[model samples]
Target: MRLEQITYFLSVAEHGNITAAAKSLYISQPALSKQITLLEQEVGLPLFERQARGVVLTQAGVQFQKDLQNILKELEHAKKNAVLAGRAQKPLLNIGCFDGSYADDFLPSVYDYLKEAASGQKLVIHKCNFLEGHEYLEKGKIDLWLTLAPSWQDRPGFLKKKIAWRKGALIYSEKLQVGKKENPTWEDFKDETCVLVKKSQNPGMFQHTLDTMELIRLDEGTIEVVENIGTQISYVKLGRGYCFLSENIIHGSKGLRCISLPGERGIEVVAVWSEKNAAVTNLMENYPI
Candidate 1:
């Protein structure tokens, strides 16, 4: 079977709908359906039970999907190795990460280490939402995922290696138009507007901090959906409101103060990948916290 066909099948299996898979693949629904039909005929079994809402994998389809995943992963590994051997500039590893200073802090060192180890390899960073990063990893769309804890739920065949731990820090500009301190506790900011980075960053860790301290009545529009670290910092700097960030962000900022969240269980950063990637084992050992 063709690799493109296999890719289309897997995408449909992952998304459980032809339309979603078509959108993801940047192809039309009719073409995707025709390919799926061709694949099913070649396999000599009805792999999916078609339904009005979406297709469900038949028993055979479920089994085939798993086997197909294994085969595709092996092929991808082979391709990566061949690409590494032939590249002129540098062997590359595409890494996905959450946007912010977290990536800025860790990626530089990681890149340095990989370059030193490979003698000439280059590491490329693709900033993505935490959930989307994991999804891409599962789909073989990325080589690595570096993200905060709680962005993931257990999935078969995936592995995560914890790298660094940092408490969420409440941060605000010293010259902000409101708020009492450089760093306010969850309680202090609970009543005022609070800007946040993204839902993928996992706000639950801070939820307990707010609840335990009896901090309530978070104002409407308090939650600003920031796209990146720079945006969050800009919001705080512009006196828009406050935000919670990794301690790394406030580490050396001239006027930024970082207050530890009450109690521990602070966020942990982890490097995640599929176990099938041969590079993962070696890279895991070399990952810099």
Candidate 2:
């Protein structure tokens, strides 16, 4: 009728004596005998034949013991598998990247580091624009964000760490020879069209570009905003404009010449997440910049 009754019945059946079975179960012989009597009454069959020396199993009792042993074995198997399944369910680490191009340079190293450092955990990645990444982080869709340090980095409830600084550079067409100098300042491209991605895609980078342009005293209409990176690169390759990009992004491209920006003012690439994420905190602490 109950699991404890079944267990008690099995123990009595195994020992062939109520006194020995009660000793094994750490209970009184009368208590063990009472449980077996209750089990026999529930099953509506006599489970034992009384003898002076001990007890012998009735025909029904032998069959019942065989069936109960199989049932107990299955219960044990299920419990073990449940424990194994719990262990196999690894913690997920969802990471956000600003763009596919950023992932191309950044994710491989990060994936490798996490694979070794946080073994048995799952890793998931999403590539989206900076604003979308920020939204994902705020809404709990992503656990970490990799992007340029934004204006809100120092705000409360967020944690931001600078992992690396990528130097800024100008990507211009080879045909447009603005200067023979290997490294040029923003002043060198005063007359050139400054093609840029949409400000909404990356407001922080856009503000930085605006600040640099202001420092050079460039005219207001000199900047051109495009919808995407491919369009910006196309404009530069056609000698129609030049664009500011991190050196890491434009490296090894064939048609464009990358001239470094002056003063070594590099863009800070950061890892950001909510301060409430203990997993993110552990990751930052383990993998320090």
Candidate 3:
């Protein structure tokens, strides 16, 4: 199938509705549907089972989606490698990190280690969200991933080490007064609702939230769940509920009060990398993480 057909198919699968997918992609619904039809004809299989409300992936569609995702990641790596080779740049090590300074303390030392020891090696940082970074690490697009733990992203052939630890952030509406304490406990949040991002969007963060809440003895009387960060933050701004985020990224915003939520189970900044990298020995040897 053509690349555009593949892209359209993925969007339709993600939205689970042709019309919604078309709107999201800024294309006409008829055009998108025609592409899907052509793709299905070429594949000789129905990818999605049509439904009254929307559509659902058939078993074959699920497998195809997973395979296509990996193929795309590998394709990206191939493109980057060709360009880097053409430029005759230094040997590259791609580092994927969550978009924040949480892991900044450990990076300077890593930089020093590379500068003093492996001077020929080049380091490139890819700032990404949890899912993007996780996907990059899995696909070998990145040599390393720095993120918050406990990482629920358990997979074989990958190694993880705790690089550092920090407090988590409590996000709430500025109008609400939980107390004057520097760090607010779950007791202060007992009467209010807690907002959570959908587990499917960020499984690691979802599991971490549950784990941290359990550790801090949260007694949430109400709960609201949203699809993503933007919607989650909207709920908080509307005073619907409070949520927790990574410490380093959560400086209080215009309408939100983001503060330390330190407790027994605090944030663990972690470094995850594939076990098969050439520089694995040097990385593991020179640094604790």
Candidate 4:
């Protein structure tokens, strides 16, 4: 019945295994197991059916989990309102950013809008990988997620709103022979090495590149992975390899030429938030895409 017990139960349910959930919750496995036991005793029903690999929720447990989620969300909302009313402090909006420049193009407008509509609200940004950002959103650690649409899969309760679209193109050094083509198809770069950002940083882009190469039957290209955007840009600039970049991001680069990929569709930038986050939902509805 305690809040900590409910949290432990939810963590175990999420991870499916006591050890993994304990590790995630930063507590001892025995302690987590004890909490679950206490919770089950109080509920007068066995919540999870234990198994060799992990555990599965009983039918009652499934219902309880859903109810707990709603209860926690409401409690969080109440807490925020209470803090705002009691202290007159700025409400915090924690945003998770998958890409370094995720907020560069659209956030200024969002800031302007918030200044007028939500005067006492404060915005905070957390830069992390796509998977980490998604985790934070799920755990109620962040209020909003701003990143490429493909970075995270659509979950049942999360609301995804597309904010912008940018054309895709190959960015290469002007000195490279591959850059000589006015428009290059995948075949043109089949033999060239491709510089790629780390998969963890942007798995969607990495998979898209693989899929594109597979579709064109161009499997001969070398793939080089770098840690970040700066490294990818440096590789392309020095002619070490070429990389794919959005058209909006390619503007004003001095030594690089961006060639449109054949039949390339643009990528979408989206703002995603939980269905329970009323503040973010409101902001998304009013903000221009």
Off by over 4 Å in 4: 1-88, 180-187, 215-217
State the lDDT of candidate 1 residue by residue for 1-289, as single tens digits: 8989999999999999999999999999999999999999999999899999899999999999999987876686558656765774776677788776657767776667766766656666667666557667888877888877666666788888887777766667666544545445445655555776565455543453344234323434356666655777887767777766666776677666556655673667788888888776687876666
Candidate 4 backbone collisions, by pair: none
Candidate 2 per-residue lDDT over residues 98-155, each given as its tens digit: 6646446666776777777777677766666767678778988778888877434467
**How many clashes (backbone N, Cα, C below 3 Å) per candidate?**
0, 0, 0, 0
In order, candidate lDDTs are: 0.72, 0.76, 0.74, 0.78
Weakest lDDT window of 10 consecutive positions for candidate 3: 246-255
Task: Please rank every candidate by TM-score, starting with the best.
Answer: 3, 4, 2, 1
TM-score versus the correct structure, for each prediction: 0.58, 0.62, 0.66, 0.63
Which window of ten consecutive residues has the lowest lDDT sum in model 2? Answer: 76-85
Query: Which portions of model 1 miss their true places by more than 4 Å?
Result: 1-90, 177-187, 198-221, 252-254, 286-289
Runs of candidate 3 exceeding 4 Å displacement = 7-36, 45-74, 99-117, 128-139, 152-158, 175-185, 200-205, 215-217, 226-240, 262-264, 275-278
lDDT of 3 by residue, 1-289 (tens): 7778878999999999999999999999999999998888888999999999999999989998998887777687678767875675678777777664445656777666656576676766677767778887888877888876754366898787776776677777755666335566668887877788778767777777876667666744666778766677777777787887655444445666666666544677778887777485457556744
> Of models 1 and 2, which has the larger TM-score?
2
Number of the top lDDT candidate: 4
- Residue 238 CA error for candidate 1 (Å)? 1.3
Residue 260 deviation, candidate 2, in Å?
A: 1.7
Q: Candidate 1 versus the native: TM-score?
A: 0.58
